[model samples]
Target chain A: MSEHTVRAYDRDLEALDRKISEMGGIAEKMLSDAMDALSTFDVALAQQVVATDQRLDVLQREIEEAAILTIARRQPLAVDLRECIAAIRISGDLERVGDLAKNIARRATELVDEARTLRAIIGLKSMHDLAALQLKEVLDAYAQRDAERARAVWLNDADLDALEDSVFRDLLTFMMEDPRNISFCTHLLFCSKNLERIGDHTTNIAETVVYLASGAPMPTDRPKTRSFGQAEEKP
Target chain B: MSEHTVRAYDRDLEALDRKISEMGGIAEKMLSDAMDALSTFDVALAQQVVATDQRLDVLQREIEEAAILTIARRQPLAVDLRECIAAIRISGDLERVGDLAKNIARRATELVDEARTLRAIIGLKSMHDLAALQLKEVLDAYAQRDAERARAVWLNDADLDALEDSVFRDLLTFMMEDPRNISFCTHLLFCSKNLERIGDHTTNIAETVVYLASGAPMPTDRPKTRSFGQAEEKP
Candidate 1:
């Protein structure tokens, strides 16, 4: 590749990254608003969250098209090619994160008119906070090309998974205590799961970032039987 | 873009599709076994599910390498390039589906000794059946270059989403009725959500197939809001 073409490809990649980051920013805000909507029962904010998802959808298409164009025109090799591919995949992940946040906001809207408080909201809040933090860290890792930071985010996904388990259990307790809360609590449960999944997708992006930077796959350890054997460990 | 090179590219794409089909077959079997593990509470089956995921991982890398090599060597243009790109993405989705199935099996192992019979299992089974069917349909669509079938699969995803909502509610009811069952119920809930996500990823692959076959971008619809609005209808 000529220097000019390489420069053009770099510029294209940087622009695509910026677009993904912008989508991430919107998704992060959506998550925060969804949580706030849940806490305050703000139906209007929840609606806004749902409406703004179209923007993420548009951005997803735009970034994907840009990546495709870059590949077609530049024929990027090795790391450059991986970076382009990762950018496209990361955009898909970010778009799904936006969708999950929208799901949470929609659930919050559902609870707007309910007369009773759902105990599951507390767990939802914890999940929301953890997912948002992971989103921010993973995006930062991508921007700085810090493979170590990306790996850290990948490892930290287990923390979110554990929290999700705790949240689900607490939600279950609420439902068991009062059958009346089943419908609302169930919505909260789905919302919490969506948030946890958003964290997982962000971790996927972090892993992709690490892979792009290192050209090495992430290590996989078999889940130890002892971990599942101990019932007292609490998630 | 000589005729000879075109034929070579076509041959390579066909070979890549065959490999992906083989991987998909293994993934579908893994999903079925994981569900079997859930139904029977068989820890051994769950362990086997986890062990087999490594094969999917290796297959993912192999397919990726093959796709990359074809792109580098064949230098396919336009629609051909898109097909190659889609092959890489669909393989990634297939691999993740395998991982999700392994996750379900892991959860089954966790709940193996639990005494309570969660009602959500029925709903989960329905979802598993539907997802596996959709995956098979999408793979068929890919093999036949059937854009219409791919679109049908896209439309079918909403049904899975509705089933997911029902399962979420049922699981919440189980959890709320007894805190003692919370741990087992939570694991089941996660497994169901994983199945739902696998369905979603399958839908994504279907969309990509449509795009590849038609050389047109797939449409992005607004997220389904009916489930969210269901909570308000109860009053």
Candidate 2:
């Protein structure tokens, strides 16, 4: 390739990276705001979180299109090829994070009329904080090409899963304490699940980072604290 | 491009398509079996579904790696490029479908000792049937490149949402009817949500089909019957 073509390829990749960072920032904020909305029953904030997801969606589409064009035009090989593919993969995980946040936030409006369960929200908030932190770390890892940081985020997802188990028990107790809490607690349950999924997406990003840095896939099996979607701990 | 090169590109695209179809078959069966496991409390069947998800994951990674390598080697343009991108996107959707199905199946083990709410399962059955049908239709659309059929799947997602609404109300009623039902019904709630998400993924696949056929992106806003993750109908 000519020097000019090489420079153009660098510019294309930089553009894709910039868009992914922008998407990461938006997705992180959405997760934080959605948790706040849930905890405070701030319907307006939740609605804002829902609205912000559109930007992430648009950015993801742009990144994907640009990445494809880069591949077509540049025909990058080896590591360059992997970077473009990583951009596409990471953008996808970030986009789903935005969707999960929107889903969490959308539940806030439903809880406005239901009896408040502040304690239940506390557990979900912890889950949110961990998920948000993991997301941030993974994005940083991606930006820095820090495979170690990404691997740390990858290994630490079990902590989030453990938190979810406790939260699950707490919410179940809240529901049992008052049947009225059933409807309200159920929404929190889903919110926690959403948070857990965010952690999953974060780990997905971390793996992508690892792959981008070193052209090899991570081990498929993550350390399992528990299989998700179970309502209770095993007896 | 040489005729031989063009033929090789076609072969690459065809290989991607075959992998995607195989994934669709596995995911569709997983969804069906998971629901069956949930309704019957079949722990072994659910375990089988969980194990099957590994195959889908492997296929997704293979498809992605192959797609990227194809771009690096063939540098496909226009419609060929879109086909490769569509395969990546559809495999992703299908892989998530497998995960969601595995999630649903995982809950079946939890419900083994709980009091059976066969009535609640009936409502979820309707949802599963609709989601399964949509999955089948969207895969058909993708396989045949039937844009009209894909559009129909995209439009029909609202029906799944409506079914979820009814299912939500029924589960709530059951939880209220018996405190013992709280834990069981919560699992059902997640199951229904899983089914709803399957619908969401089906529509995603539908959109990819439309794009693959026409090289045009669909509108961002789907016709939502109710925003997902909501616990009840609006007042």
Candidate 3:
């Protein structure tokens, strides 16, 4: 490291790390709150989740700007360069996580007056729980710079895919059982998809963390369980 | 620009740009081919699109790494810094476009044996054409560094959103009209969503182009219609 790069560059990176952590915290809360809103059909909380997404977007922009500025100003090399790029990637993931959570909340608002399909939601609930846990653990892995932890999160994503497949089948079965369930189940299908994508963001973040820690790219293909129609790759 | 930054750095930027154009070409073909696959129920074409996505993914990683390396080696400032950053951002958008196209193709394979709903696909065809046009135009905007052209693409995205709303309503009507239509219509729903997301990626690329050319970020929100549950935010 250059002598000129010590204090100021460290501060810049620390600020970025702090901002990512903040983004992660808000994303996690928004996810859980959105799920809560969905299960209970709370429009207020759902709207809150939507509103929170703006903050996440703002943070994502800020992080990207900061990272670019740091790279330009400090001219970091090797690991430091990786760190900046990883920050951009992770912030992007977190912002998408926020968006996915907001989507779930939006679906909740749409389903407010519909008949409750509690049974259909059970599979989604499991998905939500696992995705939420993955988000939390992945963020922790980032915070700790724990590549192994990130790898674990990466490995567990296949489980989320499995859950999504189950949710897909359940929602389809519900739609088949009663024509009235079509609209509601379609919204639920999107909700399950949103959750699955959130799981994906966590996986993306995990890969970034592993790269940041090891300075090596992870394998190109992740472990995905669902056989066909990979639920909408990133964004 | 720094005295040290002229020759090699320009070559780096050119390489990045060429890779982006290559990626864009693959992505555009994948999108049109996927739509063709969907309309014709061509399983072989769908498989080809799926296989093409791996190439896009590899190109994305390469572009990202090249951008970072250029940033570190050249320590580009001002417009040059923005160029590298824009390349990274635009590559990401293109990669997602490829994935969405792959997703559309995947859905097509799933629907191969099912009874065709040519009527339901009409709106989707319109969407695919528009999204394909948007992708092409936005990429031209990037190549020419024409912010005005980029802005025009950004403004047109709302029309795509309107199209998605129409498609959604049509698919839902189909599902409601015949219980047998549920499975097919649901796949169409996802395909429409995938197209809408491709539009969003174009919007993202447009914004990146505007920033790269003008050194100013676009407004945080683009013009989007269709009130609830905005399609999955960028991955």
* Per-prediction CA RMSD (Å): 4.2, 2.8, 1.8
Q: In model 2, state the lDDT of residue B135.
A: 97
Lowest summed-lDDT stretch of 10 residues in model 3 chain B? B226-235
Which regions of candidate 3 deviate over 4 angstroms?
A1-4, A228-235, B1-4, B228-235
lDDT at B47 for candidate 2? 92
Clash list (residue pairs), candidate 1: A172-B175, A175-B176, A176-B176, A176-B177
Residue range B1-235, candidate 2, lDDT tens digits: 8999999998998899899989999999999999999988899999999899989999998998898788878888888888888988899889889988988888997789887888889999999999999999999999999999999999998898899988988898999889988888888998888888889889999999999898888897777767434532210
- Which candidate gets the maximum DockQ versus the true structure? 3
Error (Å) of candidate 2 at residue B153 is 0.9
Instruction: Give the docking tier of candidate 2.
Output: acceptable
True-structure lDDT of candidate 2: 0.86
| Alpha-carbon runs more than 4 Å astray in model 2 | A227-235, B227-235
lDDT of 2 by residue, A1-235 (tens): 8999999999998999899989999999999898888888899999999888889888998998888888878888889988889999899888889988888888897788888877788888889989998999999999999999999999998898899988988998888888988888888888888888888889999999999998888998877767434432210
Model 1 spans > 4 angstroms off: A221-235, B118-120, B165-187, B222-225, B228-235
Cα RMSD of predicted structure 1: 4.2
